[model samples]
Target: MMKKNYITAFDGLRAVGVLAVIAYHLYPQTVQGGYLGVVLFFVLSGYLITDLLSREYRKNQTIDLKGFYLRRFKRLMPLLVTVFLVTSLYLTAFQPNMLNQMRMSFVSALLSFYNWWQIAKGGSYFANLMAEAPFKHVYSLAIEAQFYMIWPVILLLAFKLIKRRSLLIFSLLLISILSGLEMALLYQPGQDPTRVYYGTDTRLFSLLIGASAALAFPSQDQRLAKLVRARQKGLNRLFLLAMLLMLASLIYLSGQSDVIYRGGMFSFSLLSALLIVLSTQANLYLTRFLSNPLFRYLGERSYGLYLWQMPVFTLFELKFPGATGSWLVLLELILLLGLTEIFYRLVEKPARSVKWQSFKEKGRVFFATPATIGKAVGISSFYTLAFIGIFAMIGIFQAPDLSYAQETIAAQLSQNQTKEKLGQASMSQETIETLSQQYEVSSQVFVQEEPIAIVGDSMIAMTYDHLRQAFPTAYIDGIIGRSGEHGVPMLEETLAQIPDAKKVVISLGINTDGPVILNRNTIDQMMSVLADKEVYWMTINLSQSQYTWTDQVNAELQAASQTYDNFHLIDWYQATIGQESAYLAEDMTHPNQAGQVLYTKMILEALAQ
Candidate 1:
């Protein structure tokens, strides 16, 4: 029997990676950079797969192509298929609205091109994540699967073409750098980076780094392992430093920032590679730290943990939109562990290790035995329900005629086709929705005839018609995907056009990228723009406040309201405090059609003296 070459520390690393990803998805405010964990996994996958293949080649002078392919199928497909089935079961039984997206997800994942499919379909990764696509997590898995399919042949070719291992490693690193450059070149600031993010070519940096590291550092290199053991203290310090840096990246790295696309992730992949290389030492302190029982267990089952995360989170938030707390987290943890166990016990372990020959004899014996009939019947019933779920999923439509967001965009486009564009500001009539015909909203409403100007993000767009109706003659400019910094330019433009405007209704910060709304600098800028004019800055009413910088924005608004006399903070947050169900759309951010009317009402009522 061959002595198994396993790096214990890798499991610990996996545990850390999965935890980061989970935190990012569950509580993004707390772990903004948690998405970097996916890059770490990319590196690890490249290293492990390459190392295994390379070792086999070194030992036998050729790789067993059949065994490699078969083993990979056994290792990956069972759990992948299982997750789809179980999730399909749940969705088919309860959430038919999600059926369309789920059906598309099933097809994409099965084809092993989910990442490319997302890119092709022009789905914003962050937006889709917010949209609660259960299979959004499949992008990374798809990339990894793509690598698995094509890389072995590429590596084999490289092995034949290059005489020296060092040259091959250098080539891998060079390719990795080129991949990073591709990402940087393709990335556009202030737009969704999902194209580059989901591209296999753009995301090749980390995987190539792992491949290079695997070539340079193999677990069974006794001499290298001994040298690491000899220089334990110094290497351990370096390892600790790398670990800390990775954690810091997980804590602070913003996914949409130029820094990430340019080289933030690329640099972090190098650090991950360094840690992976250091971990190859069998008896290193890094190994000791990572190989603990808790770390090992979590790492061993990390794939299942990762698979269950998005689906569970999506379902939880779907059931209770904007509902979040420690209790929710605890409940998610319970559900994740339970579901993972089911996947692991029934599918993952058996598929990976079970032999068909042994199972054939066992099956015959089991069917012959009377006692086994009850167990067999139970198993049959479970699969029958699972199959029904699969058929139900197939019956589900591909996607809705137009999603709510898409419908909004289409409406804006159709309206634009008929109307002439506005002057200077150049906003279309569709965007402005100027209701020239005067409307009355009771005599008691203050600031209705105050030459009000409203400028904001998507929330403003969602409530545009009602805002127009509520405050006739108000200059309203609300474009989707605009943030606070984006709001500043619009605010300036609004003031440029409507100079004598009395009250400025600003709605932003839900999808803030730059400085939050109503913060000190933002207030100073707003003050400079309009010195004493009453500024009715509405608080953000986001369902999942964890994902966006809503807390910071709302906190600043509350403080600014108390500090500045003329800054009359519109307490939309308070108005919809416990009325999320009544006010919020299913997205939990925008107001529903009826809620939009109430939304404008609150703004009218909250307009301070």
Candidate 2:
């Protein structure tokens, strides 16, 4: 195996892949095809690793397994660990909700088993939520490492078993076909293909394709080299066309669907291989263009850029969630590249050069030797035993009084049933009689009369039980609807369902700015439906998490309330302004149980008047 010089077009392809992934992360819908970068990485890894192994075999008549692992460990571990540590620190300080996930991600990443861990969790590499895992980028590294672990032994065996290159090709094809069939079979419908996408078995085909390319064109033969050079101009144009196709496919497919291979990966990998082959020849225009100092610089730092980009982007989004417009996104991209370059120089480059003398060198131990072999088997056995033991304990503990425990939980939940009936009694006698005639009155309905209709999103949904308690006989019909669209459309929809409904209570604005004006068309429509009915327009609750727009919107809503005679604007803003603890959920959006009770009480008081 001869050492072929670095191909400039390949470096250019690497740059293309890196940029696509970055753009996709910055603006997901716009750059959906960016996911193909992973496939591109797989193919590139396959080609490079195969070439390295071939070179080692030719030079020393054997693969330097120890040196290979050492180089890989040294190259990948420092940057990965640094990112993981940073993510851990961030989660510890800011995102307590994601701490569990961060811990699991860190452990999986440290072990170079993130691919398997992600698969087990049923999460995609490109999923929006994966930003929580700072080291999710390492799934590719895990796949590559798993491949390396198996490839050396397989290559050694192949060297002994096969004389003809055709035999090696046949073996590769057989493995690829079998692995692909398994991948297809394992793919679950409707579930995210995170497992299939990251699994070593499924992704092996990409690597094998690269290996095939290596085998098919060993060292550049003189006739082939001349032929490639002679057709460089036409080939360069074709390469340019292919690159365009790759970009177009990425953008178009991402917008259309999330099916990874169909959208971008398949086309990108094939095109990348062709570009790699063409770049082997000297004086090629495509090669010259790709070999530019800037493109090469980006390609060199691509790994670091990929590692740091997501965490940086996530923090940016957290700080300025409203800066989601195209120009701002572009600014983030520029900032990411600049920051990545700095990190590469200051952190990654320095870490790579620093040797870990603490790592004790162990000489080549046979894969089948008792100590090495037993360690793998023992670890596997221990895990299997541990899983069974945990499950067995759970089964035994649950087996005795599972039904009783369920009943206990059910009984506890039913405790509120009594309170809800008391709240329903707060409704007027006329409204209670009307509701009882329409729907089956539950035994929980207390013998009091009240009339109110509560409506909003999930915030209102959680509060329904407590609301029923506050106004026992109040004809409380809480309908969950989105904010901004809340006022008239929701009221009309609920009124139409219960035509004889008297009092309409609005409790929305969690998902939208409170000051935003009600849709006039919807308002007119509601006024038309409820021409003679009394409507109590509840003022939007002031969240402790105040935004400038929200303040403005609340003021506008307050002004609108004065225009309608039937609408009695209850100023919840004044009452609940500083009382965040009353309404805010852990996510700081929905009202908790206590908040629901407070809100229900306010609405009941207005209806009572």
Candidate 3:
């Protein structure tokens, strides 16, 4: 008895919402309010599912509990399992450090418990690593599933107890009020609101709003339908205006503030409900635009696209670190869409169709599909228990690998000593002044003989210690300091300290956010200062790990390298990208000791010519 027309515009809206979220993840600055897409999705889900359930109740006068759950499992589990298995295989092949986290996340995602797991782990959905995880999108699915489990039972019980329409409305009103209050209190300042975002209590109102809208069915009067039809165009315009306003507000507010409140949540939920109502009512222009075939296609495959895009994005970034810029970012976006489309067609779509159809026929709703569910559950449980047992065994029964432990301790101690030495040797005011004077005098005396005077940012400083070791007898002075201090001003400071210095070596480009625009004006000024001196500019090293912005950085650096003659591009990135274990530190930012050594050797080899 569910009206097919009611579901028409929902798919198109969903397509737009999913696209928005994907674009935001791939190119955040361009689609700053993309996160709101998830909230919109939640609203749409509540409205549609509630309507479906209500229709069933009206038709049969009793809910088919098994069918309700079976349908959900069919709709969701196929794609979920496909994504989980693909990601697991990818990790097992290429990434081992991720094994533990991936397994836990996969288990949580499979069980529709990721939201709670995220809360328990205090995980940030927006953090760099979190964004890369394949299972992160499952959080919203988890929230929706939790509602599905509880709402039907409550409605069934309430229907049995109360025949009065007013009582049903009153009960829904009470639930909404309580949910709103809980959201507000949980979101108050200084309160740990992790549960509010993850819990059933604070999120139930969104579902209730949908149910309320469904209960208010369209009147049968022809005059009322005509009135609604006549006003549809105006309401459609209003919905469009509201969407634009909401998007702009999110972008502006994201740039200005960090605080999130339940009022904000309520406002967003209201806007979503309005949009859903307008779309479902077939408000002329909105429905037409949202229901376009292209959007519908994207909508049909949206879940698959969402599942596949993040891990692929991470892989792309890894393959082309330091290559992020406007154009490269655009390319990444296109590639994501193309790749996701292929995945949907070839893998996810086929798998889901097969599994879902089978499950529908069987009328069984296991955690996953019954064919693979037992194997999945068994494997997942075994791994979980095995990991725990292994960890405990290591802690309790097994002795340490003495040689390996000793070597690690020794290496750490050596690093500590070196850091202490560097700390003590850092120049005081008087020493810096004396060195400055000496550098000035020596620049004049040894201008022709001094092979190199390194200058730039932390990248230069990081290589300095090793470079000194490489050329102990050569006069190679480095005038580099901390990260984030590289610019024209810092260059001027270095030149001031060494007035007669020649043969400047520039090593910069890390920590830069946008396109690496090497100021031609600054290079021109330096050329004027060191008239005939040979200038060797090393290209920025590839990042130890990939980031969303890495492609932009690489593209800019490559462009800049092509522009300057004296700027010799070393292409160190070719060897380093995706080799995170070979270079990255615990923070995943700076290079570790082994990385420092490896990079220094590469630079020396590059300069040997």
Candidate 4:
């Protein structure tokens, strides 16, 4: 293949893609739509690869399959393997719980089918569980790799069979459309779209759009070249507009938005294709900006940046929980850049320089030194010792007591259940004692005098008296094994019965069975009914056994507070994050007396607010 001049603008685009992904990973709320950066990368790969293959075909009259694969390996694998080794060693040393998963994920990533692997494991790309999959981001890389594997054969065949640019363009367009339609048809609202999101069939449109552009505007096509040159000024303006549109989409589109999977993704592909088309021309303001030194440098290191961001963020967040702010984010970026520079210098550059015929000689020259051998052996020994140390710590700190802890947690749960049942029995016993101890006036119009209505499940029941004590004029409606859905209707009924009472405290969601979406639905339903009332919703804390749903439910509750003016979160989740284990009764889910007290305090604080 003829050596092509490097375009600095492409590096700028690369920087855009990588930064978006990093932003999305670290601060998802701020850049919810940054996943579209993956689409941009896909498009860029298709465009550049197609351009490369076209040049190769024009030069040699055929594609060199072995050479192409080798080139791709050199381009992608060195950094990938380095990251995998480092990540695996780190995980084994620090988070043994992740070892089994890392093994599967690492192998899947190595084979370039991680996206499908995740689908097979029933993992959702956009779900919170993605945090568990260390190599989840590699799914996009896998997709591009899959494209690279098959696109050449398909393109070669198309060129051999059709031999016309028009036919090739038509075929690419058809394929892209079919892929888009497949994605649209496969997507279902209110369900995990992992299959659709991760499947190559659903994601092929972006690549094909780029491919079609390459076919449509072949470098050697004089007629098209003349036409493009004639309209260069207008085309530059159009490209500038296209660039703005891409930026706008990145800013405005969110992963939660329905339009993303259905049609917006395809729209993004078109915009990316237009940007590529603009990149081929010079003298454009957008191109000049993209060709700037900063963009070019970042773009050059973008691959390493993308490869390292997830693991780095994951480890950093785990090591420094709750560490945030501008300075920390800047520090993260600097670390990412520094690591990428090292990888680029030591791994990527050398790998790129390797020649297949002289591979053994190059290897010999690189690895013959005593220092290299010593370094490798030393690093291996360090990792082995670290692994041993980590396991020793685990055994000393956790392994021997693991069974006892489970038993204790189980016993605690059983005790809470028994207490709950006894409390229910006591409710009737206390009523009987009151009836027998004091004479009731038959003529007294049975009126509930409480102004505050508190409703919840067993957790709320456990703390019912505490809540009543805190707000003496409070009506408590708590049931054992109840969920948020069951409580909303009762809340509405309570509001109806106590029309004079405008303030209500809801402490449901500890036993919610589904994901955040389901919990959010419960909140939305409750808000629709009690939109006029001052509702203070208590966030939940579940034992480690139900921690996943616990966190998600609290997140939904917090998000709801932002959306609804009348809905205020009591923030029991934050209050109990590190303290819940101490406050948990026998039942891992229910709060003990101390937890109940804290819960009451949180509610009172919310009321004060």
Candidate 5:
């Protein structure tokens, strides 16, 4: 807790974690695997907390459970409470609907069980098309808090009975191995891995790895610390290797990587533990580089940065329209750092500096007077109004997700149809026949010899009704969550059913597993199915927050369109580029009514041409 005891290089690691997480949230395309930063933090926490607990047990032969808990509360709660209160107030005042949706998550966060709560709600961390939750990052905090409470007790029991550092280290190693094995065993392919990712049982290995490191190199024991640092050359080389691997993990690892849930986490944690050990004793250039002022400053305020980041980015999305490009993301980082600095100074610093004896001490103050109370009330009111004003302006300027709007329209249409059907049934037979003739005359149903075949993913499913209205006899096979790989097979089945069809529209590529690239072979096979017919290919308009390979998929589609005479490209990417949030659902990938209309119109216009 003291300045002398502080490991400066570890602060640098903290900076890495914060930067990775923030970058991933604000600009996911840049850091596809940055969520691993949370794993880094977990390992670091396990090391530090275990060191402290071990030190306490050695000195007094008993752990101060009360003091430890109080310290944790002081260090963590103030900023968390402030952020929660501010976010809740803003949501309630401006986005009241979000408040209802977030209530369960909010409660879970407050209770420090957000990970389990999200799992219970069937949340998928890697689902590209799911809407963002405001408190999604709190899952990591829940895991850390759970470890903070439980690990010390485990350490106390181990130290009391085993009475040997080597045995404690061995025991932690065994538990870590078992934890990793459990994660691998629990993992199921083709299912949401969020249950595995969020589960404490599966994630405990990272923390235990760090704990094992603490036992191997006790930071507080001066003699042991000196002994570890004695072989400075060997320690430095190990530190360098760990740094390289850590950077490699950050640069390359992704949630989509099969290894991440299957022993990949354990591998990363071991690297992190090595970094911690090297941080304490290596004294290498990497250590010095990590201990620089800028890195240390960012690291020191990492907690505040982590807590405020998602809310700030979500606010940016709510306030601004379209995709968040590099410039906007840079601006967000600056704002995030600025706000985090302010939070650290005003809230975190004060919380850490003040040592309260009891809960009652919170009621007592340095200046207890009517003037002080009035000042407090005035400040509170100002903050409330400021948050409300900020959110209200965002609401007014930025358009809301049109998915809800589409739902409302659908519900109204269904009700009207029900009423009209009832009225028609009650009418006389002659009158009903006359009305039916009028309806048939107005309705647009193509009576061509060869109907167009439409094939694609969920985007096609969204425009199915509109497509039906436009091309009534078209053979539309739009499967939800279908990928480009499945398109050829679906096309085969649809063409078999509608063999006379002379034209087809393929709208594939929105829901590919990882980085979406147009498979040339698949397209060629589909072309063979429609040898003499014209084929229209629709480019993918992906959400920047959701998919990383939208541009790649679009580029490939455009290139393919130019390569072949029969293959025509419909520029869905260009058509819906800036109007993403407006036309698409909250996920910013799937189409709503506006998007459906836009897509349908484009197809109709192309057919006329």
Candidate 6:
């Protein structure tokens, strides 16, 4: 294959993809669809990798699988190792709270299977994205690395088995469609789509789409030169169309959108493929704009930016804790750029240019010079601290994981579910009426259906045991990650199937930071469907210091409680105020064991009133 042409436009595209991701991370509400940047990345990787393989085949009549794998290793590993070391050191030294979740991510990242590791853990990328850990970004890199490992071999086999390139490309496209179908089939609507989102199998369609484009529109012709170039004017128009569509998708798509699971991912990838082809030859207008000096600079350092942005933002937020504003964002960006530049110069670029022998010679030369001993010590110190991070991980590898808390909550919830399913009360209605009267409730309410049914998010699951004791007949429809948008529908469905469910307690408003409009709309939606039934909604206990949107959510709940006659406010926020340490978990969101009892007691008292 001929030496590949250096296309400046490709760098601009890299800038767009990475910058979009950075913007999304910095202000998720402002750029909800920016994660589509990762999708774009997958498309780019597939196209370039497939093109590289096709070129190798044309040049030598065979793909050099061993050389391909080695090149991939060199390209990917050094920076990854540096990232692991640096992040490990930072977490161990400054953010020990993150060590538990991140240690496994380290192992998975090193092994090149972090994507599957995330799915196996069942963590939702879209839920509770409070940055408890920073390595989630690595999962996308894992998928790409996995592709680099496997795709070349597949291409080699196909090259031999299928003589015609067009036929082989068609077969790849068919396989890509199958991958998309698998994602669509496996995804469960209104549930955490993380399994599909994190699965390589589901995401492969995006990459394969790009690969198909590359094989179909081979960059290197059989004569080992450029493919027949599209006319500049036509290419410019096409580039404009492609860029516009890509930007629109980036601005509008959401990670949790059902459309993405269904053919939307493929659609975006196809557009990405078109953009890649258009960018193969720089455009007169839009491509020039995209490939300007600033964008090109960012593109050159984009890999470093991608590597460093997550942790820098996460740790910055942790340190400042609820910091916001354009100024704050600018500060974060400046810090990020500075760090990325350093990383590119010191770790990533050097790794690309120098092999082990060169590195060893450089090290020996530096160590031999007394004048350079200070620099050598600084370098040695970094490695020493990185090793300390390694040992720190080993020490905590068997420590109680986040799942321990979930397991305890799960046990209680499971018991509550079992007792509720049996349809038996712990005591007769006479005892219930007596207790109701003791709490100043009218005994007349005993004539109605079961005293209270519950619909909630994870908080309900955490407190279900005490709830069961309080009202054994209470029907609970609590699920983790259940936002009001999803939980209300779930509650309605469950209530429809049950014998009697009235006077419900809704325990939503915690799973997300309310975009105020969405919050009010969700409250209105829940209340509208649940009309003619008594409803009590709980105020979330989130502190403004943690979630800035907490105040907005509580205000909406309070407003809705006044707007509808049957709607009532539980006032958990007021009840639990100033007692977070004793009542709340370390997260200061969910209740502790003692808080669970208090939570149930308050609900009983509210209902009695």
Q: Worst ten-residue run, lDDT, model 6?
A: 364-373
Q: How would you encode candidate 4's per-residue C-alpha lDDT over 1-609 as one tens digit per residue? A: 011545567888888888888877776546667789999998888888888788788788889988888899988986787777766666656665444345456667878998887676555454332224456789988999899899889878877788787878988889899999999898875334668889999999999998888777653456655666788788777877887788777767876566888999999998998887676655566777888878888888889999998778766655654456678778888888888886676566666775656756554322122232365754564466456545543433331223233334334332332332111122244443443233222212112233667776655666765655455456666654355546566776677667766778877765522211236767788888787788888776653431335656677787988998888777776767777568765334567767876676666655655
Q: Model 1: per-residue lDDT, tens digit, 305-381?
A: 99888788777766654455678779888999898876666566656775656668766321122232365664664
Q: Of models 3 and 5, which has the larger lDDT?
A: 5
TM-score of each: 0.74, 0.60, 0.59, 0.67, 0.68, 0.79
Question: In model 3, which residue pairs have backbone atoms overlapping below 3 Å?
Answer: 322-554, 323-550, 323-551, 323-552, 323-554, 324-550, 324-551, 324-552, 325-552
TM-score of 2: 0.60
lDDT of 3 by residue, 1-609 (tens): 013444556777788778777766665555666666777777777777766776677778878887788677767776666555655555555553334455556567778788887665544343222222455667788988888887788777766787885778667767776887787776634222445766666876777766665555421224434655878667667878976766664454331122444556656766777767666554357666777778777877777777776666565555565455778878877876776765455445444445555557975333332243355764464465345445433332222122233223223322332321111123345543443353232212221234445555444444556545443323333321212223445556656655555556665554421222334444555555555555565554434333334445455556655765655556656656677567744434345566666665555544544
Superposition TM-score, candidate 1 onto the true structure: 0.74
Model 6: clashing residue pairs? none
Q: lDDT tens digits, residues 543-599, model 6?
A: 622344466678888888778999999888897888888888755677888788678
Q: For candidate 3, what is the lDDT?
A: 0.56
How many clashes would you count in candidate 1? 0
Off by over 4 Å in 3: 1-6, 129-132, 166-170, 177-181, 188-200, 217-226, 247-262, 325-327, 342-609
lDDT of 2 at 69: 77
> For this target, which candidate reaches the highest TM-score against the unseen true structure?
6
The sequence of per-residue lDDT tens digits that candidate 2 reaches over residues 1-609 is 112455555666678778887776665546756767767777777777776677678678788888777777767776676565555455445643434345456557767788886665444443222223345667888888788777877876776678887879778867766666666666653334556778888878777766765665543536657776678677768767876777786666552233443323444556666666655555666667777778788887888788888677666655564355767777777877876775565446654554445222543222112232365664564455345445433332332222233223223222322223113234566765654443334323434243455554434555657665445545444322244544555666666655666776665544431112334444555666666777776555434332223454455556556767777766667766677666654333345556565665566566667
What C-alpha lDDT does candidate 4 achieve relative to the native structure? 0.68
Worst ten in a row by lDDT for model 3? 416-425
Best prediction by lDDT: 1
Residues 483-544, model 5: lDDT tens digits? 65566667777778777778888888766432224566667777777778889888877644
